[model samples]
Target: MTRVRRGVVAVVVLLSVVLAATPSTVAASSVTDQLIRRLNRQLLYMAVPIAVLVEIILIYTLWRFRGNDEPRPTRENRQLEITWTVATALVLLFVGTASFHALAHPSVSTIDGESSDVPDDAVEVDVTAEQWEYAFEYPDAGVATNETLVLPENRSIYLSITAEDVVHSVHVPELGLKQDAIPGETNLLRTELTGTGEYRLYCAELCGVGHSGMLSTVEVVSEDEYEAWLEDQRAGEADNESATDATNESSGGDEP
Candidate 1:
């Protein structure tokens, strides 16, 4: 092969090697994540070969027609045009179908008036976003936390997200969960935890000056551990309320 051909071969080989070695590093911790990862890999596999073929064809055409000769008008081939058009349409159809399959997954998106596929026992949590912080409240457990979101492993989770101030987004990349938190409007996100671990959470939208610092943690633990944590939070809240009442009574007694 000539020098240019050899260089092209080397580049293609290197790209193939890199693509083969690069594994999906983002761990899928939930059903939503798994679906998203699978769709991404499907698209990548389809796109890479097409891209490589197009590049190879372009390179070959440039090299083969490099001579300074009179250019001949290209004749249109109806058969070739029809074949390519049909092939392109099929590829697009496949892409759209695959995308819809993943995007419409109940765990990935919840549309209005459509009943979600989340399990009946799914743990529901209310997520409230402010200027620079996220607060999580477990209505059933009657516990709330701002520092960390505690969830039970191997269980479905439903998050009702809303903003108290400007627009914000709740994004937990590990679980492939992201939803906008808009003031006066609530958005729902569903996912099932598949493992126990700590995942980073962030506000994906620019809300205010402290937007960059809007961060938190999602800690998925065993069911027993989650129950214990909720109990602890409840006890702490009770103690704080008792102290406030005692202070109020003392102040009232000492009034002139």
Candidate 2:
């Protein structure tokens, strides 16, 4: 029992240390990322000590009371039992309060509220997901793309996410942003990009066989460069529309 307990303690300690050393890197692109990272660290701090203490107590009890002799019933120490129970309850209360405070925080939970944490000049992008692909549309910019998502860095973005087929999840790990895209329901998420870099966007949910292929890039560019890209997309779309219109008119004349 002592050996088993020691083994458990060693494994637990090693895991705890490793996790603490390599905590998830929060990009801190927005307030939500900061809140999430803060909460994670706080929980880790609380959990490690409690876990070690509990393991120690369990091992000591097993070693001290080990035997196959005639089972002798011992009277319960009510005060000791009460003390430990109360201690456990207090720990739970403290952790619960902390979790609730973080979850109820305004910056983390008010994604769709009327209150304006988002800037007035924030850009809006409509995100649509299907079984195996993502389509991004910038209505204001008159540009849409299926292969890549381009946005201006250091600016707030309001994302309107929806699914064309089954439910999907949109996740941008660098920004620590994720939102569910459900059919017939539009979910909104707001965040700001803190730097200009390429980030990977993934479908966090398993939609189908091609879910592994449901990958794309998020390119955060300067405002001027973003505008230029949008202009080029708009021009290409105009040319395609004109060519389609001409083709239809020529086909109609030939049929007559």
Candidate 3:
């Protein structure tokens, strides 16, 4: 029994040390991700010891009271009962209070509408989700693209998401942002990209048969590159508008 207990303790201690020394020590991109990492680390730190303790107690009890020739009535101690009840309540309260910061983080709220909960300097982008694809539209830049979300690094991106057909959820794990896109209702999520790289965007909820294929890319670029891309898009939009106007005039003259 002593050997078994020692082994369990050694294993638990090693695991606890490994968990504490790694993973969460790395830097996260956004505040939301950092908070989530903190919450996870705290939870694991609390849970591992409690789980090992419970297992040890179970093994000890089974070994100590294995053979019973005559079954005896179990006596309930009022003091013990009260002590454990209070202890459990205190533990729960402590955990809940500790988790409040992560649970009630402001970034998770979808307050008023599109512009709500967004910073003044944040760029707004419209996200439209359909069958198994996503369409990203930049009204300010006059650019609309399918399957790619372009943004400037180190800037807050305010995504106003809505579903054109069925319900879908936007999940960008690197940014720790996820929001449901419902038809006829716009949902907003804001997050800042710290590094310039391509992040994967996935539909977290099952929308249809092609739910697995509902994937996209979020490309974070430099401010200069973003500005140049916007300018090119605007120029293309102007040219298309001119062509449409000329076609409309020619068709009108033919009708007359």
Candidate 4:
């Protein structure tokens, strides 16, 4: 019985080691993902030891009092039962406290602190989604870009998102972010790109026939490069509205 319990514990430890060593780290980060992962990882971490202890106790009890040789006692160990019940409650309480802490992190309220919880001094970008395009509005910069979104690294940027037509979700996998854009209401999210690189921005929700082409690029650049990109975007007619108008004008389609 002792050997079996030891083997099970060994396996658990081995698996935990492998999981911790895996090279799945390093990527873009968002507030929602950060909080959820932290809370869930902590919960599982707390559970494993308790589970192993319970298994060992159960195995010993089963082996010691088997069959008629040790006729099952009718009396219950009320004290032991009460102790276990209190332990279970304590575990649950800890889980709740940790989870609440994760949720309460100011970052969870919005991306990069555009929400009421975070200071309003951060950069704000208005992202509007249509059938197959992601049009971003940098109100402070007076620039809108459809091809690529240029963001500054290390600083939190808040995104206020809405749909121009149907429902859509903006997702930047490397940034550890995703949020829905509804037609009537604005949804917000915060993220900080840790490094300088070009990442893919995708529409996670379906909209229409051209939804597959609803792809955009996320470019993380230094302060100077970001400012230059903003200026260039402001001077170009790369917004979704301009593209749609040009298409309709060429085809002589219905007026807007």
Better model by TM-score: candidate 1 vs candidate 2: 1
Give the candidate number with the greatest lDDT. Answer: 1
lDDT of 2 by residue, 1-256 (tens): 9678777876787677657655566466655667778788788777777776776677667666777466678889999999999998988998898888877865455343233454678888889999899999987778888988998977777888889999898888767778888898887787677678888999999999999999989898999998899889999999999999999999999994
Model 1 per-residue lDDT at 116:
57
Give the poorly placed runs of model 1, Cα more than 4 Å off.
Answer: 1-26, 112-118
For model 3, residues 1-256, the per-residue Cα lDDT tens digits are 9868866876777567657645546677666677778888777767666776776687666666778677789898999999989988987886897699777866655543667445667788999999999998987666887857889977777788999999998898887778899999998777666777787999999898999999999888999988987888778878999999999999999994
RMSD of each: 2.7, 4.6, 3.9, 6.1
- Model 3: lDDT of residue 36: 78
What's the lDDT for candidate 2? 0.80
Of candidates 4 and 1, the better by TM-score: 1
Off by over 4 Å in 2: 1-30, 62-82, 105-118, 238-256
lDDT tens digits, residues 114-148, model 1? 23565677798999999899999888788888989
lDDT of 3 at 243: 100
- TM-score: model 4 vs. ground truth: 0.73
Q: After superposition, how far is residue 8 of candidate 1 from its true place, in Å?
A: 5.8
| Cα lDDT tens digits for candidate 4, 69-155 | 757557888998999899889998999899889777655554432367545557789998988888888888788767788888777
TM-score of 3: 0.78
How much is the lDDT of residue 203 in candidate 1? 90
Write down the TM-score for model 1. 0.88
